[model samples]
Target: MTETVAVVGGTGTLGAPVVRHLLDRGASVFVLSRNATNVPAGAEHRRVDLASGEGLGAALAGATVVVDTANSNKGAEDVLVAGTRRLLEAGAAAGVGHHLAISIIGIDQVPMKYYRAKLAQEAAIESGPIPFSILRASQFHQLLDMALSAAARFGVRPTGAAKVQPIDPDVVAARLADAALAGPAGRLSEIAGPKVQTLSELSRTWAAARGKRRLPLPVPSWGKMGKAVAAGALCNPAATTAGKDFEEWLRHE
Candidate 1:
């Protein structure tokens, strides 16, 4: 039987690429999203809400594997933690074989609110009834861009002393697809970028690429969060690292 993989949040930055990869691998791919308009071609799009758990059963029906790339920075406790619980319940009921989730590296070590919610989310998956694989990845390039752009909007370029390994979302998507195909492997080795650089350096490089001249201010208010960032918890040196460097990605863009 051809494996049918349902990607929750399949229209997202990381999820969309996973959907495309599954389609290329000859798997029957179902993209579960609230808005289905932007789903990849050759994949079935089902309008469903992960937070509300509405219309999830039909979206996940007959799925061999389910990859959850769903994320919500706002109300992460309700959306990521409770949302994952809802997904696991629906998956177990629907007879989904394996459940795979994408998480962030160092979420356990970080003292931030969102990271705490992600840890809670992982716990929910761990205690759930279905077999699961959780793969933690580093920050995406877009996140850095978004942060810098937000600061730029306020006429300030906020750089930082913290470090990050900004991996490509496409690369992260490929690994996620591989995990779904390989079935349940428990908590797999993390995935990160090829190079580790400071957030300040990355922001300056990004600024130069975009021909923007602004003062790069080191964010002093990161507080304990800054300590976590400086500790290099976000970079997994032992994990399988595959992706272009931040500067390389910037040059291409």
Candidate 2:
């Protein structure tokens, strides 16, 4: 029988891919989503709201692994901290074997609100009764796309002069699912893409992909340490992982 795994908030971008990755590994997967929407075809979906810790027990029951990809809309604290703690408690009660989580590289270096929440999540997972594997990766190229879309809102895209090593989200999803399936290894080595590119450069390249122009906008800090991010916060890549690069992902190679 295939092992069962529950993925919290599996309806979103990162979580959706993670669910697909787990299913590809032959694991019977359970996905929890906020709305009754976009449920993965091969997986079971439980309509649960993580914000209130509602309906988590029924979804997590009898699972070998529970992965937290559920993010909070109320801010990082609600999702990363409160939701993670709740997941840990529920998983512990359910006798879940492992808890897998994804974090970004500059959680510590950047001092952003999201990273701060992620750090709280890491701490919560570390102290959990269940075993856990925490994986840190750099930005996803979709972030560029999201930014571009936001800029398209006002007929202008904002590109910052920051260095980013973007890996394919599908690759990250596959690796994390594999790690979760192989049993608990605790915190894994940080993972990153092969090439590092500036936001300005990547934005331009990505805009060209969408038949748009790239416009770099110099702005002050917005998040926790925005200036620090502009100064290259996520600077190191994991020695292992050896994932594909941005160009490779873009070319669909």
Candidate 3:
């Protein structure tokens, strides 16, 4: 039987590639989001609000698998944790067989607020009725690029001794698409970039990529979150690494 996959937040960076890959695999795809605009071609769009649980039922209907790439930084608790609960409830009601979600690596060890909410979201899915698969990925190259760009506007690139193994979102999207088709395997191996480099090094590489010549200002990793990052909590050495390194991605961009 052909798989019917519903990609929540399918208009976003990682989600868009997931929708495309699923379509390439011959699965019927639906992009569920609050805004119907910018929906990927070859896939249907369904407007659904995760915070309010509005339109979830209709969006999830006839879906054999639901890949949740939806995330909110501003309203983490309301949108990620609570919203995941809502998605699970709706998925269960719709007879969805598999629930796959993308999560950050070391969310358990990291004391960041967003990471805490994501950990809770994972808990909600684990305790829910549906079978699920969770893929924890390292930070994306785009995330670091955006952060560095914002910092550059202030005329200083502040980077601590923290190490980061940034993965490409397209690689993550491909893994998610494969997992959606493979059925729920539960807590798949984490994925990361091939190279683990310090934030300082990455900052320099990014600056060079953009045709700028600025040395990264060394900042101290003071707090618990910073300590965790400095201790390499976010870099999983044993993870299945398959993606473009930060430099490679920068070249393509």
Query: Lowest-scoring 10 consecutive residues by lDDT in candidate 1?
Result: 216-225
Clashing pairs in 1: none
Residue pairs clashing in model 2 are: none
Question: If ranked by TM-score, best first, what sequence of candidates would result?
Answer: 3, 1, 2
Q: What TM-score quantifies how close candidate 1 is to the native fold?
A: 0.96
lDDT of 2 by residue, 1-253 (tens): 5789888878877788899989888899888877756677889988766667888788788888987787774567876788888888888898898899988787787765677788889999999788889988888877767776787666775666677888777777888888878888888888777777777667676666677663556555566577667666775644324665655555563
RMSD, each candidate, Å?
A: 1.3, 2.6, 1.1
- Best-fitting candidate, measured by TM-score? 3
Among all candidates shown, the one with the greatest lDDT: 3
For candidate 3, the TM-score is: 0.97
Clash totals for all models, in order?
A: 0, 0, 0
lDDT tens per residue, model 1, 135-251: 999999889888888877777777766888898899999989888998899998899888788877887888888778787777763567778888888888776476777878888
Q: What alpha-carbon RMSD in Å does predicted model 3 have with respect to the real structure?
A: 1.1
lDDT of 3 by residue, 1-253 (tens): 8999999999898899999989999999999998887676789999999999999999998999999999789988988999999999999999999999999899899898899999999999899999999999999998999999988887877777998999899999999999999999999999988888998889988988997766468889888988999999999988847668999999997
Clashing pairs in 3: none
